[model samples]
Target: MSNQATPWSSAMPEAQFQLMHDILAAPSPIGLEAAMTEGVLRPHFERIAPDGWGVKTFKGHAGIVLDTHPGRDDLFTVMVIGHADKIRMQVRSIGSDGKVWINSDSFLPTTLLGHEVSIFSEAPEAPGEYRRLDGGTVEALGAIHFADPKLRAGEKGVRKEQLYVELQIHGSDKKKQVEALGIRPGDSIIMNRPIRHGFSPDTFYGAYLDNGLGCFVAAEAARLVAEAEGARNIRMLFAAATYEEIGRFGSRVLVGEMRPDAIIGVDVNHDYVAAPGIGEKRMAPVEMGKGFTMSVGAIVSEQLNRRIETVAKDKGIPMQRDVVGADTGTDGMAGVLGNVDCAATSVGMPIRNMHTISESGCTRDVLACTHAVAETLLAMDAEESQTGALHEAFCSQHPRLDQARPMGHQGLPESD
Candidate 1:
């Protein structure tokens, strides 16, 4: 019911759409994010980034940062991170019947049932080399006829411990047969779904859209900043980070090493307006195809948020405010977790069915976020040109509560 035109109908370039598709299609599940960070994101940055831009890699993880104006002490440094990791299941144990038991970390058991998946096993002989096995479907208590009365009546909930992958192995020594194929404990498993346009205009749905959309936006925004005219007074670091699903460990490492003056964690937020059974949850009414989301609470920097809001207003970009309570729930918390002194905030596109095979998002919101981030960087660059101390200026701009004047109301008297 949105008025926005679909990407097919709009002016979105073919190459951009293709890049988005490729990023989402790349399997970079949690601990195995090198597939995306190295294969997909690094290539895209190398191709489009300007001559002065250089890519930096972490020793501890697969996280990569594209840096513009590196090692400039005079300039403010801002890191815009989009996690390249997706939640995944890990091979826990294999049974003699050829059933692959998986630890469904971060995924509800109900969501995994009946969904096709691909398990990636690192060849023990080759160390880092991975072998992917397809044609497996997640299953639990296979048939309704075999289900107990409580399960049939939905009185019992499915638990992750009971789930196993149906690989349909035939013949004796099934466990050895699986092992011969390079499958083992601690291998990664992910949904075998590809990103596709949705029935609605400007919408996309697929597995791993949770954070792929984030990386895509960060890449696009970096491209925009690189192409823009003017001498940048601030160094922009666009990072495709890894291990966000596990505990944001990769981003924490990146921030601790880079030590940027500001950080913007670009990730996905739930489209609470369209969420089922979300009554009285007090969640923001963020919806797909509306605009990008800006985090307001938690460890978010008010001055940085205000700057982004000003930039969005000036550029005519649409955005929604998201209230994140204890944490932003994205890489936005990376700086805080690492005890780094930096201004941090989160920006995201509203998504539906996060952590599921069919996560949904709006292309329009993605594009809007890209523009908003790009413009905010440009705006800060412009500010630095005039102020000559962008970081110090931002630090000094925090709102002073004592300076705020009290307003009179019908029931309350005005302050003197």
Candidate 2:
């Protein structure tokens, strides 16, 4: 709201930017997010968490939660979640010609063509051990000359079923050769693209920005909240969830288990203004480098949203209102789907080309989200210190239609 630039609008710290790059570089495709959860998120959390803070891991998955003021029944609990899973392809089968058939999960066939990928295959003999197979490219109808006239002319679209990984292993027993390398039918495959700065300032482009950006934002916010000085009457749960690309199962599980008083799901959103082929369908004019995004519909809690907006406005942090109709399409719905009675909402940074190999986002937006979330949590703590009943305060602050005053007509007075 101020003409002058806010502190968060500027470039983030060099170490923080490096942490973002590290998070995006680590591969954590759906059903296999341990590489991200244990390798990147856990270490980051441990490094920043205060002495009293603790970490909680789920039973059978890589989902993790960092807790502040744990096991405190007298304090209000807020769970901020960011899922760690990235959309990925799975090995469906292998051909004798060395072509590896794959199932494209949440990706269009056209965007995947010629993109390099790394296949993460678990060893058959050593079930827990894994091998990374590089130097493979996703392909379909190899070479423009081999395609049908209709397909080449754009009359037909290439289907995911027809896509395969061309490993270029030449042998009569190509299937046997591939099997010998421990590439099984269920191995996960992910893009090998690393995060890189875009042409513009504070912009970055890369693969798996969908949820890694979310996790990064959440981690940074947790660090900020932990460092803030306050009475700290609220219990903060910063969760890095898994399996969100599939169905948001990991966040739902965490929500059900923790059953917090409120939840804020952090994830990436589309920059609809710059997105291609979104003809005639009305969408929020969200853009990258503008600010972070806040959900305005679905299961979003009005009181919680107002709290976040107040913090952003007071801090001069920019944010855009995102309209999500039936569902937020993020982990914000975890509490709802888990049947937990709690206030919930989503916050995100807008990016271009979501779900593609070359997704783009702005560091300014990421920092804005981080600041907004951290400031909001600190604000809640301050309010709780004064009110002594944080949960009741939020629950009682919903907008009331009866208290609304009619707006005065500015047009010429109606003639009687």
Candidate 3:
């Protein structure tokens, strides 16, 4: 057990809440996460890991490695991962009506209609501009005309298509003027909404809540561990990875580089909720405000999961168990599959309306997850972490990992 109080067990609730608000205020839509990463996450990380820890950024994927060993060349490392990127759409073109074209791998065109959006440009300096776009009714196209009314065409639900956005301005000349302001094709677009508060003292709502909440929890956990003194033998890594909504692109790069003894991918998990057509697909037995979740999936290491559960129970932190069949659809699977030796599992904050702008969760659950993670990391021993019995068991279940590609062969660029 760790001598240090589970850092963030007390004052961290408000801190995590504020951090979540700040992260949500910034517009971080998918590939355009440079602002969230370089602008927001970097400064916050520097503040938390100011001493000997080496902070590095790779293509907007930022990480801080805490070297408890200091000058020692060899040290055991455990990584906590969270994606900095959120799902968003890209600008396809500028319509003649001074409107913008929209396309996304994740949202239906109808769902975006009438919703406010923030357009992100390459502006590494000032963030993007916000505008409201009308999602015209099914009977008629709104301010921006769609080539096909089919944009809203599903009898049962909204049909997804390439959509369009209209600014308050109009005409081709006005469109050119708007483009001149640095808004151009290929920029990213995301739903815009102010943070909603007081659904109850414990709950709140906002956009990008899916994984941003995870990042906030991880940051709080890191703050506690960095400030503690007794953690001298086990090195810890805090990875704010990007581009997880589309795929595990950022995490694959990070896990290959860090190659930690164990990795915990922090992300949002869904609980019981009803959706059209899909019915209760969004429902889980877990509840927000109740606690964090330990996901069971193909990539989750049973031993690592048991360790986390033990920590949570011993510390009296509330927690729940969830199961996802083949893939958990989070970075935990990516890290585990890519680095066979590293033990991997996922810790989730129960969230509602995942992937939509108005995602919501309980602040109490966020703090609980932070406390659980901090306690788990603090309790880990270097010698015990390096053992790969779980990895051996996983390999036995899937023989092709050895035949198709051997372990310890994949290499990543050296960390800066």
Candidate 4:
């Protein structure tokens, strides 16, 4: 039965969530280009860019749906730059006193496997003193924790607990230094913490779940929709984009080209840290183990929001709402101005000590967003007319959310 008809019988289900979790558990964030191409995404993703320099593209079966203009084409393509590559670990616990810890409670977010982790030298001169270890504790989706204390004199403030790991690098003998023959750029840093699950039901603690969790939701939903074949008119495009933190450029290109009727960009939303004045209402309120969060404000479109809300209400999809004053800091910007009828929202995970090293989130929350997105895909029109909504939302949020700074173009050629 269709999700609408039976309500309880949508293609995306609880079991699917578990399956998705395992897939996300795979090491290395995105499917390798060679594999994704020679293996799976080949049929759908069209490689439009020149190869080499870690760049690849894929042109797919479906295109983006343009924003309401009544007269648009079916070119709505949702480009997703996910974390299938790169690992930013926070294993080394640095005390507020600015002391370093290689073994203590410090932790870095890392992928699982015999994957190599990077650590610098204990160069006596700087960073207090810390170096890499041959082997240490880096559990899947986890890292070590340390005790926070003043390592020496004149150190006041401190971050309580921290963990760290060592990373060895191989460089040219001619170019090697003490810290050299160590870690280098583009090294795949794995976490020292192992992922653990409590006896508790449906709970998990792991690393890389930050975006991996998000990817799980998106991929599985696509799998389910394909199986059910509920609606033929709806064409689902699952884009595994890369280089988001690098500059959010991958999706930028997709939005420009795809031009979907409307887009629901699935991404991780920052959790609310109990700051002095920031109440739950003001900042996003995505508590772990809850459902997903919906973004509001400039980046997210009004009409797009309405559509998502409509779907949620129609189905039993659980969601929370967040209001963004200036920029949602999401892929929302691309959807709006990139020439598409788009509703930008997020399925967020409540991450703790984000960007430091090892990030945290609830597995349940991840699953919910995935399911919600899948339902959205099936429900989205293979070809929906962009009813000028993109332009309208742009006008409203443009002045306020000056998110994307203009990339000054090469001016007209000088006169002869």
Estimate the TM-score of every prediction: 0.94, 0.96, 0.78, 0.58
User: What clash count goes with each model?
Assistant: 0, 0, 6, 71
Alpha-carbon lDDT of model 1? 0.87
Per-residue alpha-carbon lDDT of candidate 2 for residues 25-106, written as tens digits (9 for 90 to 100): 8889887888888999999899988888888998878999989876775678998999989899999999888899999989
Tell me how many residue pairs clash in candidate 1: 0
Candidate 2 lDDT: 0.89
User: lDDT (0-100) at residue 44 of candidate 1?
Assistant: 88
Off by over 4 Å in 4: 1-188, 192-194, 273-284, 336-343, 356-358, 382-416
Predictions ranked by TM-score, top down?
A: 2, 1, 3, 4
| Residue 181, candidate 3: alpha-carbon lDDT | 61
The 0-to-1 C-alpha lDDT of every candidate, in the order given, reads: 0.87, 0.89, 0.68, 0.45
Candidate 3 accuracy as lDDT: 0.68
User: After TM-score superposition, what is the CA distance of residue 36 in candidate 1 from its true location, in Å?
Assistant: 0.9
lDDT of 1 by residue, 1-416 (tens): 23446331254576787899999999888877887889999998998787888999877788999999767755688999999988889999999888999999999998899999999988999997888889999998889998899989999988889899999998999899888888888999999999887888667798998898899988988888878953367888999888888789889999998998899999999888888987358788888877889999999999999999998877668889998899999999998998999999999999899989989888888888888998899999898888798767776888899999998765866679
Candidate 4 C-alpha lDDT tens digits along 125-186: 55434444444333321322332244233254323233333222234432333233343322
RMSD of each: 3.7, 2.7, 10.3, 14.3
